[model samples]
Target: MREILTLQIGGYANFVGSHFWNFQDEILGLREAGFEDPMIPTHGLNMDVLYRQGETRERQATYTPRLLSIDLRGSSGAVNPSGSLYERPPPAVVSSIHTWQGPAATFKAERHERNKFLQSLDDEEAQYREQPGDAKAEEIVDVEVNERQRYIYQSLEEEVQFSTDYLKAHLHPSSTYQIPGCWQGVTPFEDYGTGQGLFSSSARSEEIRDRVRLFVEECDTIQGFQCFVDDSGGFSAVAADLLEDVGEEYGRTPIFLFTVRPPRKVYDTLASKKKKITHALHDSVSLARLSSIAHLTVPLGLSQVAACSVAEHLAILDEKDYHTSALYAAAINCITLPFRMEAVGPSDGSQSSGLGGTDMGTALPLVSCSDSRRVAMMQASFPSPALLESKGEIFYNLHNTSSLTPSTERPKLGDRVAKLLVLQGTQLPGTTGERATVGQVHKSVVKAHEITAKTGRFSSRLATSSHLAISECPLAVPLPFPFIFGNKIGRFGNILSRTVGGGKQGRGGLDVSSVPVGASVSSSEAVLPYIKRRALDLQRFALSRSTTGPSLLQDWGFDGEESKDLRERLTNMVAAYSEMVESSSSDTD
Candidate 1:
């Protein structure tokens, strides 16, 4: 078994990770419930790849994700830090106060109460424990449990108070670590340097390192690390430091990093302008540093997701982390699906090794283009158009769900590109809603390739390679998922002819069980603009002497020498993309 250790870095990263884990938990639940789908007979998924099984001190079996999450104090909301699987020992009694020799003041705060959904989960667990051997009793207790959970999920507010509110997976006791002396609203952890010196203390750094080493020690064959970081804030620095330590300890282990951010609202004010400048500088430095340590880095999140083409058919709130994180979680889940697949046979020279088997080591190079371009962009089509319409026509449109490109213009010819496309749960065209077999899916992909070739979708001066991976199993939407779908979506994530309204309007009333999704991670000239924009912002603000750049740099602990180094690093990154484009164009001419 090749194990991949997962890490979630900040509040928003945890928000995205929470949804990702919930999807995994839902799949596990379905398997345990004996749920079968004829359309997807062979899932080919090995859950052990991402999970670990062990026994607690009391000899109770426990199954949990091999994950490590770091966040600010009080960010976990009502979830216990040690989780609920293991029993907690009672606090030691203090019989005497010999140090102070005086009355000590005591202040107690109100405890957090569980939400309705969590309460229901507790009740179900209690009932299950009461009758562990009684199947009839279990059935009776769970008769209307799903319906109740769905209703509660639907009634949730648009804003997510905390990531733990929707988390479904049970984490190990050491999986979560909250930074001391840091609170979300009270502490100002908003810049690239705010997290500096946080782990300088030997005790803190050693503790975190020990937690990671514990998980790594258990793996027989370690594949790599999968990291999700919130790059919009100080967590970028935190993640970079952690990864550097890990890289030093574990030589040459590939780290696939997904840097994410929630949508931010733009304001027209002097303060906002200064803030934006600082943020731009932070972003440039964060990307440069993070990408250096990571084998492959994928930038995620849009400034305004509601304005993106992917949200055209759906209703989403731009300010809600709950809504935005769900979209990111879906894409992340689908893109990483190839990592857990079972190896069917020998390699077939495909990018993903013929869909029979693939790992982070094999998959990272495909999108990174042999390390010449380590940074890539992600685009996905959630609820992809793979089903037959009511008029018997099949639409294979894959929309741009990512913020990598704001426009829909075609790329210039002679631009080199490498793309990896992952399509899941697609049905064959002309079928009566029957899921496509593996062979049929391959045929559909071939047709897609032919169409793209005719339309010049991937025309380039140099060679361009596109790899396709197909999976019959669709992404299952758990009850805790945010209500982001529109009224036109059907139960199975297909589009309907008319809008149906029976539940609350604009509240995602449609009962979407699962969705066919298409996602691609690519390294090409198209992502040049994204890189150049940040580089330009950094140059205009940080490298200029006429502005407040120098003072801001000093405030972030970047001395003159350090600032120069960062600028050079970012400039080189942008130059690499430009050189690729120029080289391709020159060859074509």
Candidate 2:
């Protein structure tokens, strides 16, 4: 079990910083399922930003550290962070060892003692950085970035001198030590303090400290480090040589190569569009003449849409020739995403009912119709009179196959029309066990029975008087029929001589709803009932802009005080939602 758990933790750590992983998609799906913000994607990244959001701030109103675990291990073992054995669990004892060690024994106590002993050894080693035989106080000056190279030289000299003396005393042949003594080149060894914290103390001293620190002691594995600068300023000859020597000792490569880049300044050229100032960098210490590096590619404007297939095609096409032969050739093979366009209603921004805006210089018309009569107005291809009176007995057939293509070939004209008809609002139905669609494509299928009867009754009601009293909330909006419908019935006239798909001529201000077949009908019925179930789904959605309080507050421009207020409000809302759900479920029960 431990091995399996360890593997799982390792796998998680391996991808800890990987960006290409699809964490977003997985989290979005969770959001759609109604998970609260705290349990979802918001917890994944950019945690600090989220804390500023309004509601998030409120949720953390209470804080308590829950004593979440009890350690069962009772064994003595060395805790070596660098050893491979660190990954394994320590051996366990059959009985409690704390009884013998006493109540004072604890992991913290053991760790503290170990650390104190290590500190003593470190303090003793610090003496090496100063004078020998006579201890004198020395100032631990902060390293400056500008003096980094010089500092590296001084630190390396101390380390090399100490190492040479030690080697001569221990492993070196007698001759090397005798020659140094005879040549009067032997130097007393001095101890340099630990290089830790020197790199960040000050920019100048840090550079010098870091450059020579590696030579203080040899390490089995050498990790290379880098720093970026606006200009080549602190590199030195001794520093460079010491680095190369250290690298050779560790079988690593080392060199200080400087590259000069173009300075930032304003300049202009006779180009149609503006461009940023840029230039390639070249190595300074090259033995031969240097060649130019590859030019950087910078994407701009429409070219950036290459990441999306549909955007790429649209960006390339011109509006004037968008539907011409050339466009067909270009777009035919273009990868398409499922496009969905909805006529958002003004009230809820949902496609729920009658259109918004005026029907000319007149007040909005409220018309009434019987359910049966209204059903007749909604037809598939055409309406059958017998079935109209028969109620919605006959099912109307409408194909939404335009967007669909055959497995072996491209979409045809019929498929395109089918897609358009479905988008325009048509109804289709099927049973649970059916292999194909339930409705048939009859030449003159009747719409639902109730709508047909309603339209007829409405006409009869209008014929009775010139001034008809419209209801407060009528079943339908009485759009003025744009074209003249003479007493001649069953004849359909063009409401707009030209509209969008009505050819090149533009459409006049007319009630478009009256002209199109089943235009007043809801567009949702065309899809299967299961697809429409999305409306009833009780999924939690973000009312607040962000999942976290800090981020939500920051994004909505809420100040600290305002954020605190909003957070409290959100907490109340969450409580309300929970109560509502519980009440609803209780009622159902």
Candidate 3:
């Protein structure tokens, strides 16, 4: 099995060949931090690392055309006679479903289950209406727990709905054919030209903003949280309290903020007229009308679910309840779900979901506080970069593998080139412009191969660097594991710092050539001799003195004729060193 890491880039035009191409910058950063290439097996390790285990076969290499090259003018992919193109062709859909079925469906089912649990609590609350407050203490606490959980779920569902609706509204024109002059209020584009325009809301908009602040303030009180941490780790609980007091006095309860904007096609369809004939007495009226309107559309099922939940909340809530702190919280939660969206127009494709359209309805379950223990166990077992770098235990032997082992096979040309390019980070200049400079390459080669009187020594020096550099390419991808489990990592906070820190001692540093010329030698012309002397010095002392362990030269999985060539070159250098030492000794005697 083979694994292929596909690079994804945001823009192909600007970053086609640069390090930033396909997010290489981020991937490289991850590599430097100790991540390893992902391994893929068809039958196993296909699931999340939290669940999967055992050795996995890697997948074949895969690459895609740049994202920027996608044709947006009509549809996507091959065009039919009617000029229709389908984006996200069927193979992608099948792949997505096959890979994510468990994770996606589980999340949806979980939300439904949570809703049922909340409903049960509501029923229990109704039965205790006649009891005395102090006498039913146990029941009251139980009911409160249930109510709180239900509130959280309800809030989440509403937030998901609102989010979907907001997106839908943003995609469609605010005014329809029935209302020609109608506008989607509070256009985000009002502040387009003037950056400051976005911050300066109109009076009515400010009123809405104030209401939102009040709702958030009330939410804090409802949640029983007295303080919240700012980015700097400072606490601010009193600020909301003060704001609430003023809002209460004014009877201005905050409502959650909502906005909508016009669709792009509306302006594009507007007619433009340039009159060429100059009329002596012209008072002509010209009118531009939209010939046809293209309806904005998104999937229907998601919006339907969101709409149903929203309708239920709207029915239950009083006018004042609409402005309640809980309402805002609930709205926010409902709209944020992956499936939620506003219904703009009818769906473009068929309504039958599973039969024709690939099922893309589900999401991963939200990790609950109660499941923390199980999650912790899962996390502990995963192979995070920190664990690999910690050098806690050598799980796989990088250096002692058998000669015929799969791991020791000769690398492909691309792999060798990748290694050398990666190594150039340390040995040559880091920047492309610097390394690509003709003068620098000439100087580096002349200095590195000074002892050799041969004219074509630059190519030999480059080859030597490539041979030594091929050992570190595997670290370019992330390991398929987690560093820690449960509350151990504390929600993305770094917990394996020590492991990563300790392992950094064996990490690579900048590759610099040492020259052997005289101490007083100076000048660009003297560089070749100096570099040659330094190369000889390294040959003699690099094993004990260089930062990287000398054994690492064999760890990078070099094989085939390439490895033989490198070994022969090193052997010749050693012999030359011995002869030079003997000659110098004889002269001294």
Whole-model Cα lDDT per candidate?
Answer: 0.75, 0.19, 0.20
lDDT of 1 by residue, 1-589 (tens): 9999999999999999999999889789878878676543335788888899988889999889999999988787788877988875475486775777678654343556777767767887896778466778659867586577667776565425889887889889899999977776767988887987676668789999999999999998889999999887888888988999999999988899998888762322556667777777888888778988898888887767877777765777888888888888888898888888777654332323126357888888877875447888788886676533325433344333344333222345456767777877775543233455555556555554455567763443323676667677778878877888887766666656777555544434236777777787877777788788777877788768877777887887788898887777778778887887887767766
Angstrom error of the Cα, residue 337, model 1: value is 0.7
| Tens digit of per-residue lDDT, candidate 3, span 443-471 | 33334334233443232322212211111
Off by over 4 Å in 1: 39-42, 89-110, 132-147, 265-273, 346-356, 370-372, 387-414, 430-433, 455-463, 503-510, 587-589
- Candidate 3: residue 120 lDDT (0-100): 41
Ranking by lDDT: 1, 3, 2
| Candidate 2 lDDT score relative to the true structure | 0.19
TM-score of each: 0.89, 0.15, 0.15
Find the candidate with the highest lDDT and give its number.
Answer: 1
